[model samples]
Target chain A: MVDWIAAFSMPLIQNMFIVAAIACVLCGVVGTLVVVKRMVFVTGGIAHTTFGGVGMAYYLMSVFAVSWFTPMIGAAVFAVVSAVIMALPAVSRRMREDSVIGVLWSVGMALGVIFMSLMDRSVVTPRSFESILFGDILLVGNTELKIIAVVTIISLIVIATLFRDLQALTFDETHAKLSGINVTVMNVILYVIIAMTCVVALNVVGIVMVIALITIPAAMSNMFTESLKEMMIVSVILSLIMAFFGLIISIGVDIPPGATVSVTMGVLFVVAIVVKTAFGKITQGKME
Target chain B: MIPIEIKDLSAGYDGRAVFSNVNLELRDRDFLAVIGPNGGGKTTLFKVILGLINPMSGTVKVFGEEPVVSARKIGYVPQNENLDSEYPISAREVVLMGMRSKKGIRPFYSKEDKEAAERAMEYAEVIDFADSRISKLSGGQRQRVYLARALAPEPKILMLDEPTASLDPSMKDCTYDILRKLNKDGVAIMLITHDMSSISHDVKRVACMNHRLIVNDAPEITQEMIALGFHCVPELVHIGSCDCGGHNHG
Candidate 1:
């Protein structure tokens, strides 16, 4: 335990812990809306689709030899664009939602692969792709931590200010509209928030694992809570616990932190579902 | 004063009209029931009046202005299919949504907002399940909660689209009775539904729309109006012993 305390003193572990806490809290709040709004597939699409921007940033950095260029900017831009593209068809009622999402999902990945292959071979490397897919949480830098913190604050402020409008919009959009809430504008803002969240959480969990972080904990919370407030509270708590446990286990077993974090949350999610189902059955039997 | 008025309104999707050449006027003390066949542009008319969709041509005024401008004075209950039952909200919380328009910059609900929500819940007879999960409630209970949500804003006019679609007979009767009481309290109501039996006695006026608007002060439904409303008038059913057919002397 003394060694464990000392180990946490290292800046790298400390950064990992800080990022985990921030990401969990952010996911907890945002995830509740995502699940309740049924934006799981859309969010997943945004996450995967951001790779297009990642590939663009990589190709540009190599071509221009600009050390200042980073994938973070690329991810932000691509995420927003992808979200808008995905949201347009659904909002307009012109196309079926699933088909549009499916198309964007594959097109995004394909565009990323194309951009990567088009890059200069000498600059492109296999290790770079691995870092994007499976994040190296042990290497989280101060810059990344700052970015996450800023995003977390922004997310909190926006969600807090729009809490009432969001509640109405999510529950009954027609009523919200009649109540003078701008449904279209609010929807765009929500998608943008989701995009920014995806970009901020990308470094902590990587593109593949970020959706799980946002969705699983919220879904777990939904199994028990009755109100959106309670769901958010419980989800945030669950995210922090999962993140802490995953971080500790990664340190102990010498495994990749990102994969372990997602796996830990996933296993716990399954366990929660089973327990809730069993408990529900027993209670229902008694009532009958 | 007229709370809702539409003149020569033509609205639809993809530039194709769902309703055309429509006209209507709703008075403050009016309890109007809009009944027609499925896909007869009933919901579209409500959307136009609610400012969800723009009219292709013609003018619409809600409370003597653009519908969006006076939206705060209007309470709307959409089809229950539009409200997801799986949402994580309590019955009271659902009602509190009515106060959202009034909560401009305040992050939290005020004492007055809470009081209004409580009163609305009480009026809707859903105070007992104020804390219960909305999804766990039965169909009738959920309907009551939604009605309370609409009433929480204290709107001058209430517009409901098919509030009794899936309810049992007794539940349907209960819902109609509540609407009648609200109407008696001088709240203007615009109800769009297919079940003419339950609402014919409660409403003061009747309208039928199938791309065109037909309004009548009496509860009687004429065969000419039915022919124009349903495009064929296959068979007319009498509602409330008021012969709904063969009244050509309009």
Candidate 2:
């Protein structure tokens, strides 16, 4: 049997557990709105743009000697700016959202690689660079963990306060606007919130794979729950379960936790589909 | 203040105009019907009146104030509107959303707000499934929930954009009956429809639209008006009567 106590004693493993919980909460809250708003593609666009932020953080830290601009802070700022650009009606009206996303996606990735190339090798170690793309929970330090926690708490609070407005907007915009919610402003705020989440969740799933964490659990919960409130609760719980188990299993197997976690949820989502479909068919047969 | 007053209105998307040089003046207790073809700019007119889009050139007033300021006084149901089938919501919550204008910036509902939602749900005949998931309900049931949501605000005017577009004939009748009841109770109604059969006794006025609007005082359907508004006669079985009931076509 594995020495569970010894594993728990390790500070690195302990940090991994903490990240699992916080990241799950962050994912659950933002993800439910993203899926409901049919903004998965928009989210996917933001997730990729965050890599540009990570690269800029590293570049500014080493080259420009900006000590305060950590990757999380830099990513947060970059993400918000990008999200606002994406949210702008001017941008959408001038060009299709799909085309805009494509442009931003390519530019962000290219910028990331170019910025990494300019950085000193000592600052851009292969493992650390890889960590920016596909996350490693072991890479998170005390500061990163604190940033993730603070951001997650703030996100949760905002979601709680504006839950009604977001709910109405997501379900039907025309009605929400008539009911006195500023639809355009609410949309921009929601986008900014999701962008910050993408930054905070970087250590858990990294930039490239972040959309899976943001979408999978909420979509899975949608199968079981009817109300947005219950769906959010169920989704958070489901995300926590996936994050915890995925962390432990990856630790045991000596694999990448981010990849393992994403795979775990992806598989569970398929299982849910199969179970729901089979159950539906069986009930229909019984009725017949 | 007139409930709705518009003059020389020209509105559309981009640089093109959908409808131009239109005018309207709604009475305090109007039961007006606006008729137009599918692409003849019915929805754009609503957008202008709802303060969703700025008009290229015109003036619009709701209850003597700018439409944006008086938007709360109106309850609107958009055309062919459907929430995501898998969306996480219930009828009661949707109904409560109607009361948002009353409690601005305060997200939580008060006791009175909850009671109003109840009254709306009862009126719409959807109290039985008030707790049911919106996605779980059938088409007709979902329409009633939308109606309940609109009615909960207790607006001075109710605007419905093809509210019964998806319903069967019987459901359409029920929807019109509810609208008539609301009108009789002194709430003005502004409904958009493509159906000529809606030229009924309850409608006090008719506005036909193509690239412009013509407000008809006599609530009667004329072949000339149909030809002008629709741009062409609809290619259907013109049995001289509408399919829903024995409403005349000629």
Candidate 3:
């Protein structure tokens, strides 16, 4: 094996690992709520739908010469707007949640494609749209790492500040409302937080693979935890392990980092389910 | 002090009137069982009082303040079906949720808050299951956990929506006994239930609700009043004086 220790000396490789660590932490913290609240589909919608913003930004840059605007900003804005659209109707029974998600997913992707098609690639920094679909983690730079770090800190602070209210809302929204939590406002805040997470994590896992990183570890952790807090801690640890292993494997095999990481998570999820089932059987036998 | 006062409160959703022109006053230390059919405005009334839904017209005041503003002093137990059993939460953690409004940007619960959670669990006789996962509990046990959660914040009034809908008869008796003890302790109790037989003699004041409010039609609810509230003879009406049998609806 090539000396992994020497590879750490390269700033790019170093930044990649740091970014992975921070991304995994964010996934673990926010993904627990996503799993418990059954918002995986909504999160997926936001991730795929954010392409609309990405497209809008590129289109603006090509046509209007708005050189300062970036796809990241576009992605963030699109993600927030779509999340609000999908989430508001969900709470009020105005529309079925699955239908809302399905509609947004398709429309968002179509908007992104249309925008990208209309852009002139020569005038702006060329980021391959395909790379965005399946991440380019190897090319993550200092600026991307800084952005990720800032988002991670903000997410932690927001989650910490609203911990109890969030707990009530996730467990029982009506109870949360009666507790004077302003459930609608809290729901909106959660959607925004999910939007931010999707935008920041897009750099590490991309749109196609972000849901796997956000949910598989959380599901695995849920199998072993009695409380949401415990689940979050366990999930963070599992996500870090998967990301590190997946990163090393991708380098060794010369494959796409996003797909490798997602496959690693999928394999771990299966392992967890098997182990939990076997452990349950063994314990039941002992009890008998 | 009157813990709850509703004056000409008319509320509904999606522009349909579930109830209108209602007036209600919940006296201190009173155990009022709100009996009605499945969708005959009982829940709408509860929503109005809990400030979850705004009224189309008129006004609702809890402790002489707007219901939304006074929500902190009102302990509420929603229907058991509202909570997902698959969620990873302990009984004690669920109880601590009752103190969320009181917590208010504090990063952690204080020692006194912890004591109150413990005390509430003890009151509901579920202290032994404080650390148990809520999903592992029996239905009756889960209901008690929810009761403890509602009691944790120590509100002047406790509102329960369909607390005994699917429980066994013995469990139903236990739930009523707990509410009676809480009522004796000077906490005003308002329960919304379809099965009037589940409520005991301790619940002297009954509010019959249809598309409108009927307050104190009798010291005890009459079958005629139940018929009015149900709008039709229910398939399985479970009142002490009624003779309806178990009839399944498809």
Please name the candidate that would achieve the greatest DockQ relative to the true structure: 2
Best by TM-score: 2
Ranking by lDDT: 3, 2, 1
Candidates' DockQ values? 0.58, 0.71, 0.60
lDDT of 2 by residue, B52-124 (tens): 8889998999988887888888888765455675688887998999889778877588999999999999888
| Regions more than 4 Å wrong, model 1 | A1-9, A88-93, A120-127, B103-105, B229-250
Better of 2 and 3 by lDDT: 3
| Model 3 regions lying over 4 Å from their true place | A1-10, A86-93, B217-219, B230-250
Candidate 3 lDDT by residue in tens digits, B46-136? 9888887889999988999998799778888878877898799998899988877676656678888899999998888778778888888
**In order, what are the TM-scores of chain A for the candidates?**
0.92, 0.95, 0.96
Candidate 3 interface RMSD after superposing interface residues: 1.5
Global lDDT of model 2: 0.82
Top lDDT: which candidate number? 3
For model 1, state the Cα shift of residue B159 in Å. Answer: 0.8
RMSD of 3: 4.7
Estimate how well candidate 2 is docked, as a DockQ score. 0.71
In candidate 2, which residue pairs clash?
none
